[model samples]
Target: MKKTKILFYDMKDYDIEFFTKYGKNYNFEMKFLKVKLSEETAYLSRGFDVVSAFTNDDINKNTIDILAKNNIKLLAMRCAGFNNVSLKDIKNRFQVVRVPAYSPYSIAEYTVAMILAVNRKVHKAYIRTREGNFSINGLMGFDLYNKTVGIIGAGKIAQILIKILKGFGTNIIAYDPYPNYEIAKELGFEFVDLDTIYEKSDIISLNCPLTKDTKYMINRTSINKMKDGVILVNTGRGMLIDSVDLVEGLKDKKIGAAALDVYEEEEEYFFEDKSSQVIQDDILGRLLSFHNVLITSHQAFFTKEAVEAITVTTLENIKDFIENKPLKNIVPQDNN
Candidate 1:
C-alpha cells in the first residue's frame, strides 16, 4: 500500500507548521516547495499524485498540461478564490478542489478593522502619537453611526460583516446576484441594485469574488457614480477594482480614503519581504504615496484560526481526491 504523495508549491512557514501537523495523521508524503507554481515549475510535479498551491500560484493551461503529462491527478487550492487558475482550460484533465470557507470571522473582522482605520484614521493617529504630535487638526473623521454602508457580495464573510455593521447602527445595502431575501429581512439590511449601492453608500466595501462579471467592477464609470469623498475598502479580490481608475479617483478627490488589503497585481509583492527593493508597479507605488490610502499585504485571511482551518481543509481535499471520495468543494471546469 503506497502512500499518496503531494507536491505543495508556494509553501510558507505557517503552511509547513499546520500541514505537517494535520497531514502526519493522514499518512501522506508531502513535498513542500517555496517557489510559487507556474509553467516553469510544472516539471517539479513529476511523480507526485497531486499538486497543492496557494492563491498566487499560476495554475494555467500550460502548467496544467505539464502537470497532467507528469501524472498529477488533482489541483488542491488552499485558498477560496481560483481566479488565478484557468478553470476553463482544465478541460477535464484533473479535478480541482479548494477551501471555500475558512474562519470567515477573520476576514469579516479585518474588514471592520480597515473600515474603522480608514474612517477614523486610527493608524495615522497611532503614528502621530508615537512621534509626540497630538494635534487633532487635519484629523477630522466621520461617525459610523447612521452612516450608509454598501456591501458587494453577500457571502458568508459578508454576512458576518453585516452583523458587525448592524451593531454600529448603519444603513446596510448589499448587491448580490442571488440575494438572500430571508437573511436581508432578518438582518434588517436592504438588497439593492449596483447603481443604487454606488450612488448612496458613504462607505463602500467590496466582499465579492472575482469573476468575468466582476473584474474591474470599480472602474471609471462606476467610480463616477459613487458619492464624493466616499471611504472605500476592499478585502475581497484585488482585480475587483481597476488600479488606474482607483488612483485617478483618489487624485480627483472623488474617493476620500481607501483601505486595501488586496491589489490587482499583488502576486509580485505580497507575502514576501521587499524592503531591499523599490516597488516596480507604478500603480502600487502611487497608491502607497497617499496619506489617505492604506494598503496592507493580502493578509486578511492570515489569522491563526484561519491558517489552521485552511491547512486542515486543504489536506482533506487532497485525501478525498486520492481516496476517490465525492468532492463537495470541487470547482467544475465546465458547466456545459
Candidate 2:
C-alpha cells in the first residue's frame, strides 16, 4: 500500500519542527517547500496526494486548476482563516480542510497585549526607560475602567477578549451577523448594530473575518462616526480596515492610536526579515512613521500551543481524508 504524500508549502523552521515531530506517528510522507503555493508553484503538487498551504499562500482559481489537474485530493490549511483561498474555485475541484480554532486563547491574549501596549504607550515607555529617560511627560494614558469597548466580531476569541476586558470593568458591545444571544447574556456583553458600535466605544477592536461585506468596513464613512481620539486595535484580517482611510483618520486626529497585527498587503513582508531593506509599500511606511501607531508582523496566533494545535489538527484532517472519515472542518462551497 502506498503512503499518503503531503507537500507542505510556505514552510518555516517552527512548522517543520512541530509537523515533523508529530507526522511520524501518522506514517505519512511529508515534504516541505519554502516557496508559497501560487500559480507558478502549484505545479509542484503533481505527485502529492495533498497540498498543505499556510495563511499567505495564493489559493485562487489558477492555483486550484493546477492542483486539481495534479490529482490533489485535499487542500489542508494549517491556519484558521481561509480568506486567501477562493472557495468557489475549489467547490468541485478538491476538498478543503482547515484548522478552524486552534488555540483561541493565543489570539485573544495577543489582542489584549496590543490594546494595552498601544493605549498605555507601553512600547514607548520601554524604549524611553532603556534610553535613561524616566520622565512621564508624554506617557499620559486613560484608564480602562469604565471604558466602552466595541468588538466587531463575537467569535470565541472575541468572547475570551471580552472576558479579559470585563476584568477591567469595561462596557462591552459586539456586532456579529449571527449573534449568539446565550453567550452574550452569559458574557455580560450586548450585541448591537454596527452604527451603535461606531457611535460609542472608546476602544474599537476588529475581530471580524474578512468577507465581501466586511472588507474596508473601517473606511472614511465609518471612521467619521467613531468617537474622536478613539483607540483602534485589529488582530483580525488586514483587509477589514482600509489602510489609507486609517492614515487619514490618524492625520485628522479622529483615531488616537492604532495597534495592528495584520496589514492588507502583508504577504510580502510578514514572517520574513525585512529590517535590512527599505519598506517599499508607501502605506505601510506611512503607518510605521506614526508615533501613535503600533504594527506587528502578524504574530498574534503564533504561540507554542497554537502551533502544536495547528499541526495536529492539520495532520488529523489529512488522516481523516485518507481513512475516508467525515471532514468536520471542510470548507463548504458557499461558506461566508
Candidate 3:
C-alpha cells in the first residue's frame, strides 16, 4: 500500500516534529513547505493527499481552486480561529478541519496579563526600573476587586477568564448570544444585553469570533455607550473591534487604556519584522504612539502547550480525512 502524502505549509520546528512522529505511526509521508500559502505557492501541495496550513497563510478561493485542481481533498488548520480562510468559497472544494480548542488557558492567561500590565502600568515600571529610576509617583493603580468586568462571547477562553477573574472578587457580566447557562450559574455571572455591559463595565474584553454580524461590533456608536475612561482589551478576532473607532475613543478620553493582541490590518505585517523599513500603515503607526495602548503580535496562543495541542490536532485531522473517519473539528458551512 502506498503511504498518504501530507504537505504542511508555513510550519515551524515543532509542527514538523509532531507530524513526523505521529504520521509515521499511520504510514503517512510528510513534506514541509516554508513559504506562505498563496496562489503561487499552492502548487507545493501538488500530488499530496492533504495540505496543512498555519494561522498566517492565505487559503482563499484561488488557492483552494488550485489545490482542488491538483486533487488535494483536505485543508487542515493548526489554529483554533478559521477567519483567515475563505469558508464560503472553499466549502465544496475541500473538507476543512481545524483545532477548535487548543489551550484556552494560554489565551485567557495572556488576556489577564495584558489587563494587569495596562491597569498597574507594569510595562512602564519594568522599563523604568531597568533605567535605575525607582520613583513610584505615576505607578498608582486601582484594585481589581469589586470592579465590574464585561466579557463578550462566553466561549471556552471567556469561561477560563471568568474563572480566574472570580478569584480576584470582580463582578463579572457577560454578553453572548448563545450563553452557556451551566457555566454562568456556576460562576455567578450575569448574562445581560450588550448595551448593559457597555454601560456598567469598568473593563471590557472581547473574546468572540469574527462573523458577518460580529465584524466591527465595537464601533463608534457602541463606544459612546461605554463609561468614561473604561479599559478595553481584545484577544479575539481583530475585525471585531473597529480600529478607527478605538483610536477616536482613546483620543476623546472615552477609553482609559487598551491592550490588543490582534489588529484589523494585521495581514500585511504581523509575524514579520519590518523595524528597519518604514511602516506604511498610518493607523498602526498612530496606535503605537499612544502610551495608554499596548499592542502585541497576536501571540496569546504562542505557549508550548497550545503549540503542541495545535500540531497534534492538525495531524489527527489529516489522519481522520485519509482514514474516512469523522473529524472532531470539522468546520461546517452552515452553523445550523
State each candidate's clash count: 0, 0, 0
Which candidate achieves the best TM-score against the true structure? 1
Ranking by TM-score: 1, 2, 3
Clashing pairs in 1: none
Candidate 3 residue-wise lDDT, 258-336, digit = tens: 9999999997778777889988999999898888888999999989888778877887788888889988889886322
Compared with the true structure, the alpha-carbon lDDT of candidate 3 equals 0.88
TM-scores, one per candidate: 0.97, 0.97, 0.94
**Clashes (candidate 1):** 0
Runs of candidate 1 exceeding 4 Å displacement: none
Candidate 1: tens digits of C-alpha lDDT, residues 1-336: 799999999988888989888888896999899999999999999999889999988888899889889988899999998988988777888889999999999999999999998888888898999999998777789889999999999989999999999999999999999999999999899999999999999999999999889999999999999999999999999999999999999999999999999999999999999999999999999999998999999999989999999998998888887788999899978734
* Whole-model lDDT, model 2: 0.94
TM-score winner, 1 or 3: 1
C-alpha local distance difference test of each model: 0.93, 0.94, 0.88
